[model samples]
Target: MNSSAGRDFRVVAVQPQWHAQDFTSAGRFRAWMRSQLELARPHIAGDRPTLVVLTELNGLPLVLRGAGWATRLGTFRRAATALFVVRLPRTLPLLLRERVSPIRALQLADADTNAELYLRTCQALAREYGVYLCCGSAPLPRYYRQGRRVRRVPGVLTNQTVILAPDGHLIGATNKVHLTPDEQTGGVDLTPGDLNDMHVYPTPVGDLGVAISLDAFREDVLGHLGAQGCTVLLQPDANGAPWTSLEGLPPDPAQLRDQPLAWLDSSWKATTGGRVRYAVNPMVVGNLLDMTFDGQSAITGAAHEGQPQSYALTGPRGGFLALMPWVETGPPEQLRETGRQLAAGSGHPHENLYRTGVLSADLHLPPSRVTPPTPTAHEEALAALLNGEGEWPRPTRSGRPAAWLALLGLIASLTWARRRRDGDRGRACAPGQRPR
Candidate 1:
């Protein structure tokens, strides 16, 4: 049993630069997503499966897809306000039923539409390429299967990561057990997932684990997934601030690692000790609805050791197999400058970081991962057509949809949702309060 001959798996982290237009419409969103997948296709060969992981929030922009005004607005505050006014009739109910503010209600209302746009696109791509696609993470009302029907759980929403098999079937979904500061109260206010709910989905490559963004930083989530026998870990990241900025000081600031160094810890440190052999961190780049995210995608192996305490993304360091080209490894000032440029919204600077690229490594399946799993518990049948699959899901609440008028609120609902969620903690700036 030669390990070299058993090289049947590859992992490619797709660092995508998302913009408002990419999610302008269902067709446009699919096109943009497909183009990114095309970039990863080169890493596939020999009929061996490749795991393509897109960065977090890579598809979350769908909330703004059909809403022209939201995308055109400079800040999400004005956008949310406009959208709220237009969709007050629909948003009003959600606000009351869910006992949430305007922002959360907007997000809740648009869940079904965004879910459809995201799931449909990813599934098609997974089937077309015949690769295992970690469709990245999105905040949507909790979707569960009811016999052949797929329905959203009324008020519940989670930042969920979904995985699709080569056959385009949903293999598994893991929720972000831990929420970042920005995702909690007075923020997006999404429900945090419980650790008990984590699932390790088996793939051609191995038992796969997906930890969305911040989840990779904590041991609670990593340790639990490791205990479940994950060999490959995917940390789909959407670093809220710039990639070079220092991490906020926790209670114990004395032991903090700065920026990429903290991310590197997610590399070797996040493997569930030696149980998880490899980790892939795909990062999102670009400013979506004014909330910017930027970072270098990275892949790490457990076998490589004795790396420099500090290393740059110029090449592989420590156990990193590949890190996308990122030269802004700097003193926070660089990130601030990038922010300034973004504020101007004029020309692109450090433009390479926003280009779609793949950081991939082909590896021999470890002995532990070679054995495929025997079917266990009840697997949901590849969901039924589910009320509507072929058509772009309508956002209307009721009635024979008026071609023009009925749909106005629909677009505004989604637009407002994204604007609220896209805003830094639900508001760009408070009344008379300056934004840093």
Candidate 2:
């Protein structure tokens, strides 16, 4: 709906709030998402973001929440459940919804296998939504637990993404390269892929790359994407604020200190000189006990002649940043040349083939859209933590006297109970001539 050819392109990036608790029920979650979409409608209607990206588990969370009986049972039993049975049936039902499982939501392997189905979903969403969607990574079938020849039917990782046109056409996809230890340890059981081989998609807007949360932190991954003719990078992240508990008050003073921002600065600077754009959509809030996505969705880089400029969006509750319009200023060949030149200029002691060019952008440029927010109590606490303003309520040490008393009381009570029990047993045994 909104065009960005002549003036600075309006590239709006939004980090939608995510919830794992609601994932099991798609219908309820869809309605909730529609409401969230409504909150974002102002941006969509105003900016017409050619490529709109939601955080990981956007719609799938609902499917995950309302998981079919099969997934629930398989997950519960920790067994190799048939992927096709939970997803695709031997026969296609008149209604596709009844048959396809979350595992078969969209085919992820080999671009040819079910690429059209994948594309159609993207196309449909694009058409219906009137915007392009850059999907986050989802799980795809990879060899899990060596030597276990479980039926490796159709399946996808939960961290995968599907990019769609405003008309919902499939554009391109990037699987998450890095998996957290917990994820790897969990039944997710996804193997690490060669991130150095990054994929780029040439879209109506520009060449874009999708990088998931942990992968986004990798310098090699970002550099690879930049080198592979990718100018726009979409990072749908799952990282969030670490809280003590799900229901526990939003991160206490000490807890809020855990948010990581250093990696972001390094990641952005990694592809600075190149004509690439990077956008990160991290889930800020969610239902998991320890996991809570902290929204910091942003768009950076304008592929100008000499240097590329960058801008980031700072807002609360998944705010929207201005659309940094798509402009074809640097060709892939030029980018390679620039990369070579920059790498050569920055002669280091070590010969690193991956040291591409670096450029500094005037990121202070005005954000296209800005909305001020009223901080919640939790946010206020987090702000204190960020500012290093508040003191962590130190744990008060318990008195030693109390511990001694407790130990002595416990010994006394146990001894008395033991003696009483023994006496009763002896009396019973004597009267009955049998052990009681």
Candidate 3:
């Protein structure tokens, strides 16, 4: 591949701390974001259109800061319990009600005042910095326009990742398709966006694709993006406690390299066969109320010929990693070979580490010939099942009889218990004259 065929652009991924105190004041949150962007500005090189990526749910603090005492006191576990199990029976009614879903209501009540502030701040930062910005992820209410008024519908919320061009234009918005089990249990009740709907946003550097944390884990999502000619992947993540164990593990360089590399291999390899050349994951750091975020923000690529390697930041440090001017590299086979060497410990783990604070590299775009395998019929069927499509198996008429019997049994047991309770009360009343 000709070196001149490649394009050069700067990309920065940031990991930031979200303190409880910051959420108490909206100005503090905006100030924090501005400071982070200013810090990243010195690292950005060249006049090439740069792309800056942030973590998921980063904007949620704005909503939290504006929420009432009830919501402020509600932890992730408590919110999940109330939203999922407690509200399951009321799902239908919530959906039917006009803008009355609990999640929507909470977001509306808390975020209504600050949502615009958060978005405007991001847009302002992007424009001021002259870079494309993946502002971060937030669980926001979905709205529809009715005549002159725009209203949020009930029972619908989207975990949205917004992309802003350097000119402050809204380039693209990708909603998360895969929701974690906890998100479902927490009464998040977010409507999943279509994977097919995600499109590549063209930039001077290359085409960019954005995915939320869990969404990045899905091969289908990455595969589709690859097919669409996206050469760069930006994932904003917020995988915190319980789901990730960051308890006692030291942030040793080895541990950092191993953990994130183990997870990044699939996506990196997928990029080898797809149009994606590089992937940047900026994860959340620090504790948010009850949840502690694990931060190992990284940039991985098959850019080098010897082996595909990752440049990662360990521990819960908040910083940015920049990659400038992408170059075209060798075939996908070289990437596979690189992976093998790394796994075998032949490749140097720390070769790409620039310093404690920054990691800069010349990214290589995968050869055009590398193509992902086409899905087979069986795989397609399994995909449908995994995506929750098609009709589920229904109970037969014979099963209905058993269900009816169970219901009757429950009713009879309740009635008997009630009569026994009444008899005991009557006997107690009659014996009242004799005093125990």
Q: Pick the candidate with the highest lDDT.
A: 1
> What's the ranking of the predictions by lDDT, best on top?
1, 3, 2
Clashing residue pairs in all predictions, respectively, total 2, 51, 5
How would you encode candidate 2's per-residue C-alpha lDDT over 30-127 as one tens digit per residue? Answer: 45444444444455543324455555545433324324443443232111222222322221220133233222322222212222223334444456
lDDT of 1 by residue, 1-436 (tens): 2254444688888887777788778888888889889888788755566889887766556656567778777765556656655666666566656676666666766777777768878888988998888888888666545554555556677888878888877677777877875566545667888787777766667678878877887778788888778878889888765554445433343443445666655755664247478888888777666565666787777645434333332233466677676544555566546544553243666432453488788766644543333322212322332224223324556342345433554564565566546664644332212100
Model 3: worst 10 consecutive residues (lDDT sum): 427-436
Stretches of candidate 2 off by over 4 Å are 1-9, 45-49, 59-124, 140-158, 243-258, 270-275, 302-436
- The TM-scores of all predictions, comma-separated, are 0.80, 0.49, 0.61
What is candidate 2's CA lDDT for residue 172? 41
> Given candidate 1, what's the lDDT at residue 95?
67
Q: Is candidate 2 or candidate 3 better by TM-score?
A: 3
Candidate 3's displacement at residue 34, Å, is 1.2
lDDT of each: 0.66, 0.39, 0.52
Say which candidate scores most in TM-score.
1
Query: What's the CA RMSD for each of the models?
Result: 5.9, 24.0, 17.4
